[model samples]
Target chain A: MGTWLALVASLNGLAAGAFLLGAFGLLATRQMLGCVRFFRLQSLALVASIFLIAIGMRVPDLIAVALLDLAIKPLLIPWLLRRYVREELFRRREIDQLLNIPTSLVIGLTLTLTAYFLAGVLPPAAGAMGNINVPIGLAGLLLGAYTLAVRREAVPQLIGIFAIENGSLFAGIAIAPRLPLVAEMAFPFDMLIIALVIGILTRITHERVGTTRVGALATLREGAPK
Target chain B: MTLFVILALPLIAAIVSALPLGRKLAPSATLLAAVASVCLVGRAALTVAAGHRVVAVPDWVELDGLGALILLLVAVVGTTAALFSWGYIAREENSRHLRQYYANYNLFVFSMLAVPMLVEPALVWTAVELTTIFAIYLVAFDNTPEAVEAAWKYSILTIMGGAMALLGFIVLFHAMRFGNEPFTWAGLVKLAPKVSPEVLESAFLLILIGFGAKVGLVPLHTWLPDAHSQAPSPICALLSGVKTTVVLYVILRFVPILNASGRINVDRWAIIVGLISVGIAAFLILQVTDYKRLFAFSTVEHMGIILVAAGLGGAAAHYGAVYQILNHSLTKSFCFFAAGTTLLAVDTRQIADLRGLIRTSPIAGVALLFGGIAIAGAPPLAVFLSEFSIFRSGIAGQHYIAIGLLAIFIIVAFFGILHHLNSMVFGEPMPQATPMTPVHLPLSSVLTLILAGAPIVILGLYMPSFLHRILQTAAQGLAG
Candidate 1:
């Protein structure tokens, strides 16, 4: 029993660490490909966390959810994104982020602190699960918001969004174990649809402007085009 | 019987419209389905007026006084739009695109109908999200790059807002788990007293911002003008008028819970956000150049006004909000329909390019003029009645500053609308070197104009006893 508990704890710790690392790397990394790769790693860590939780809780439905996450997040989404990147032949080494890396990193650290502070504020409802997982989820939320605020490239912004979803899923598993399985299943389907739509939009963007950068397409404005 | 008809009729019509045979029958079929849905909604409204809650699918779908009021607005406008589409699409000339247009239109109506019927919070979230996805196709139907980009931005912003709402739902589910019963309105109400105040407060805030984005409150309202300006005129009517109201209904669903929990103060926050949105959108309305975009910003302004009334939380204020919703749905959709006719005649959405509408098409010109007056809250229009009630309630509630600012913004916006109406409806017709192909107005368009215009005229002069009772019940529901 001790061994199993230790294993589960260790895996969760590793997953949480990987999530934080990926979030920081997403902010720190200048290259678009590097951010994508970091997101893939973050998704892998998410899969591992869910798998560990399912084994610890002896919940079979969660295992199915874990499998779905593995199949879609780590495999299908990355593959689709790879095709988009290659076809577009993006050569830009660094995206002109809204905020510099240093500033984003500082903001990320503050967000992590806020998450930790918030976790302390949550009253114990789902045992130690809430205590441990809520902060991680908060971190994920902040990271997603930060990515959305800073990133110029459409693809990286999408990754940031998925990362936020990953965090919310983690929080859901910890806080609401009895959440209807149907709702859990709906999450991946929604994500898949969002990914497909984003992919199509990216393709269209590439076709229209010869680049996937969103900032260039500001010609259609209110009153008149700038 | 009524609930099932309301849900299934439009869905079946949408499916049939996608078929080859249904192409020739598309307009009439949609009109028939819409009329059927409206009749059912009217029956539901009557039932609610008689002091009975209509539980459609029991735990999964139900209609209360509030839902019934929104349903009536949706049904009335939907029927009108359907009638208008019949004549409007025939003028398209391009057969394939016309078919696609009707198909999307039917699906859009189906989604809007589903929103009020959905009872479960999670189901409501999904329904609202479906409305966004369905409307995206409509917004981008023109296939113009600008239209497509607007659709994409709209989809992304709304979906992201939906994600936040999903998180809010998760929190709500967690809070509700303290109760013994399943997830339903009754269950939530029963559990409200026992649930943690902190959880309820946080969940309410999340839902507010999440769905508030969809309601096109300022800051998050960036997509409203873009999507409204880009989508076809009929769709603009639905998007700005019915669809936003449906999402606002979802947000309003949480009010009773928040009030019951006694931990969160909903009215104060709603007032702050409402005033800010109304004030910002009113100014932005003044600066806008595109006529469609002007109406689009006006939507944001009106939504802000309704929210402000709702936030005031008195019997009169709540009733005013409900009345404003119905009036805005009628007036805004009428304006859009007129805008569509004018666009078809003049071939431009730019306020400067659209002049001499009266000389070109007097029917459209009169429609635009009257529609503009109605939206601007002219006397003898339902909007004027509702806005007056709201102002009276605001002052009664000791919100003197809010009332003063609201009046100022409304006056400014009225002038802005007048500037465009003057240019578009009264100027001499711009001469075309080549004789232009005359586009005929649809019977549906005429029906839409009448249906949209009727409520404004009738409700302004006198409020029916049944509708007055229904609004009172709905107001009480919000107040609780």
Candidate 2:
């Protein structure tokens, strides 16, 4: 392979690897602040990858996407989380975690390996996207789902979901340069609505039962008293 | 002209309804737009029934056979819902909450009308998601703690599911991008055969699971009962009738593509999920105590039956599925209307709390009885004919297990509904008089009953050529 092409490929690989690594760390961390930091790092890595792609393909859209990632992921979302943390005064660790940090880390590792292997098995229709970027994307999906299943706090779970969205976004960019701007715009709208709804639910939870822990919602079980 | 009118009328009405002047005129304004749109949709349906597509606004929006069928649904039900909301909200006008209720009601109808007409898939997603956001306010319209809670749960759960749907769309976009087509419905349909199987499989699964949540399929239907029970009666009718079915239409749009891809046996997966959903919801129907919830579970049950029909994967079953869609939308909306009226007179939704409805309000009692008989698949009703066709097709396919289970569940659920209707509508009156202001029953309620009820009666006895053509085209599109 040409030297320039090799360098571009290496940068893409490094960016995807960084995203996968940060996803694992986010899933492994017990502290909410720690999770936030890991997610910020993952976003930073995403920015770097987008920058590389823009330079390589000379596409302005990739650069625009990079700016969006830089603005929303590292800066805005974390600020929102910090403010929510202070206002809710929720310091107690989240309860009802389905798995511990170690087991989750192991699962995350297995997912990353599976992602890599699965990418190899896929028929290569998407050029570089089908071969390299898909594995990292799948890893991000698995990790995000894991976080969704295991995390007890609403904020962290939301962050995990954002990570999964980012992963899919990156995969789309890598595979198809002409992805519909409308669909991309819809993602943020969806995120904004989800965050708004979750914020409202958290406030309701605090007012009603004095905590945002979802475990308390078990009172509405089937055949239970009204 | 039709496209712009269909798209803009509701939105203009919604904005007008938010104004102080519009509040007084909201009902009439909304009813006007709805009636106009229904007439336009009926014309579009006829055009398509003649084997010519309604390509409105050129590339931006078009009505093919599938779109026409759905537009007909949105227009008919939307008009009825608007008419019902006039009286329904007037009854609440004495309360401080009436203004916001009318505004949200307008927006909700606007969103539903937009869903089936938009030709772009991404635009359709936006419209569908907008419906959910508008509904959040409506679900919590009463602003009680339970109402607020239900609204929150419904919004959060559905939005989360929408996130998955967005991912699916992105995947499909990528798949189509490589094949020299844009993200329009026509583009996707043209390029679907050449799209990679891996991408097709992932996209189909994601779309199914995501849209399935909105359709109230099993494992994602936790919000239906709460949302249905809490929302205003007319809104409940819309929710169960047009809203969920439109989402199902979105999912059905991809079935042909997935089938043609020759990758990922989607039929088996659809059938399996459909059967399980049908079986479980049927049992749960018997266990529900709230009348609205009983109706809500019935919505889930009917959705399962539709999916099962769609999964059977032939022209006959496909037609049956389409027929079921029409029957379910009309019958379910009528059921909600009746249930809402019953609640107004009885002042409670608890099935055990209602009795002697026939003594208290004969109009409402008979509506409830007819709705019950129609929804329970009694003979000479639309649901009976459609469901019988589905079962016959299933049996023909040697799907004995599915047919047997479906029969058992349908019979069991019917008896459960029958028991509830019998006790609530016929028994001795509850001791307390809940004295409610009797607002004049709007022409819409009577109209909705006739519009929905007449089809059930007419189609059961005689099928019209135009209706049969639309169903045939829709079925052909589904089977691909």
Candidate 3:
């Protein structure tokens, strides 16, 4: 039993490390499609972490939550995006960021460290697996917010928002593995709706503005000279 | 069962409105559903007011005094907005997809109704997100580039906030789990004392900033004026009037729970955050160019006031808070309805271009002026009474600094709003404008202005004993 527990904890640690890496990839990647790829990677890492944490914690409910994340985040959301978003969105690279890649990476590192220190403000995690999941999950969340701050295109920002959710749930799996199945069941469906709405919105924005670079779509502001 | 029916009515109406049966059927069905929901919700509120917790599914679906107040507000605004939309959208868009607009409208109403009805925090979060999803198309209904742009901003920002709030709810669940409580608001309050300060504080802060964005609190409120201005006016009425309040209702659910922890000064945080929103919104209202945007900023101000009142944390302040919530929702909807009629009459949103509307359209000019006075908290209006009660509560509680800042900001916003409305309603005619011919206002909208405006006028003069009881009960539930 001890060896099995050690195995699951170590695997959870490895998946969490990969999850942080995926978040960094999302921050630094120049291509919109690269953002999607990194997001999928992060989601897969999340599934692995949740599944391993379920095993480590002996919570069967989390296994179902992990499966739901697996199906929706990776498989279904991307498919819906592809179906709804224009083909050109994939081909076009979003080079215009509010900050340069190197600066963003440095800030991302700082944010990760900040997350580590911030997680100390909470009590010690419930288990060995939780110790790995909580701070790393927070880093993922902070990094996701950073990605949103820098990314200019519609799709990358949307994906950035997704990463933020992934970050929270990644921590949530370890922290509140026993959350009711009813609420857990709602998460994937909510994500599906978000993808659908954003997908159609991306299409509308592109058709109207002739570009998905939403940051450039800033006609509405206060005190514009009439 | 009635709670379940309140939840299901809007869903049924959405389907009926979506059918290709003529445009008349869509609005009729939507209005019918909205009115029915309000009736059911009114019944529920009376039950709550009479000291009964209406639990549809134990720990899953329930309505308390606080929930009932917000639900009733949403239903009322949803109904008026539906009625206002009948004439507003029919003439403005005249597009082939009018049925689609009503369908989306009904769905949006359904999503809002779900938020206060559901007892589970997670389900409530889902309902809040659904409100954004269902309303995105409505925000971009005109499909104009600017409108679509506003919709995109509205969806991304608020939904991003929703994502952040998801983590907060999880943290709350984590805190609650340590104490073996059910995962509901009532359960959290009961479990709060056993929870650690750091865990509960983090959860509270995360949800505060997360949902605060949707509530149009400052720094997160950049999208509010834009989205509120660009949506069709009836939708603006609903968005500004009830939706922000609906989201804030979720935040208020945390107050007693946090206070129950007996550690974190959640009231102080509420005051600081509320004051900042009110301060910033007051200044923004001063510089606002569009008429609709003016109301949007005032929304931020009103939200701040309620937060401050809630933060003060006494029975009187809590009463003031709920009263302000009720007054703001009603008066603001009327303000938006007036804005809608003015938009139809003049065919422009520019405050500078709207000169001497009294000469061109007396009904719209009078309505706009009335709306401005009522919303600005002038004499003999519902808003004035609520605002006065809050001031009295603050003074009585000895929250001198917050009261001072709140008083200053409210005055600034009042003058700012009335100044703009005054110039627009009673100024020199802009002859250079496009012929300045008076456009005939839509009949349904005219009816809506009269229907919605009556409450603003009547409530100010007479304090109905039942509503007073309801507000008192909601305040107690809030203060715990």
Candidate 2 lDDT over B332-351, as tens digits, reads 98898888777766668787
Q: What residue pairs are clashing in model 2?
A: none
Error of 3 at B49 (Å): 0.5
DockQ, per model, reads 0.40, 0.31, 0.79
Query: In candidate 3, which residue pairs get closer than 3 Å at backbone N, Cα or C atoms, i.e. clash?
Result: none
Residues B1-480 of candidate 3 have per-residue lDDT tens digits of 999899889888889888887768888999999999989999999999999889999999999889889999999999999889988888745534788888899889888988987889989989999988888998898789889989988988898899889888888888765677778888888888989888888888999999999999999999999899999999999999999999999999989999999999999999999999999999989998999999999999999999999999889889999999999999999999999999888888999898998878889999999999999999889999998999998999899999999999999999999899889999777876434555788899999999999998889999888898889889988976
Which ranking of candidates, highest TM-score first? 3, 1, 2
Backbone clashes (count) for model 1: 3
lDDT of each: 0.78, 0.76, 0.90
TM-score leader = 3
Q: Give the per-residue lDDT digits (tens) of candidate 3, residues A1-226.
A: 9888888888888999999999999998998888889999999999999888778888898889889989999999999999999887897788899999999999999999999998877555667767888899889999998898788899999999999999988887777887888899898899999999899899989999898988898788887755
Q: List interface RMSDs for the candidates, in order.
A: 2.2, 3.1, 1.1
TM-score of chain B of 1: 0.95
Q: Go through the candidates in order and give the clash count of each.
A: 3, 0, 0
Candidate 2 stretches greater than 4 Å from native: A1-5, A25-41, A69-86, A89-103, A110-125, A129-132, A197-211, A219-221, B57-60, B91-99, B432-452
Writing each residue's lDDT as its tens digit, candidate 1 over B127-153 gives 787787677778876767777677767
- Estimated TM-score for each candidate: 0.92, 0.90, 0.98
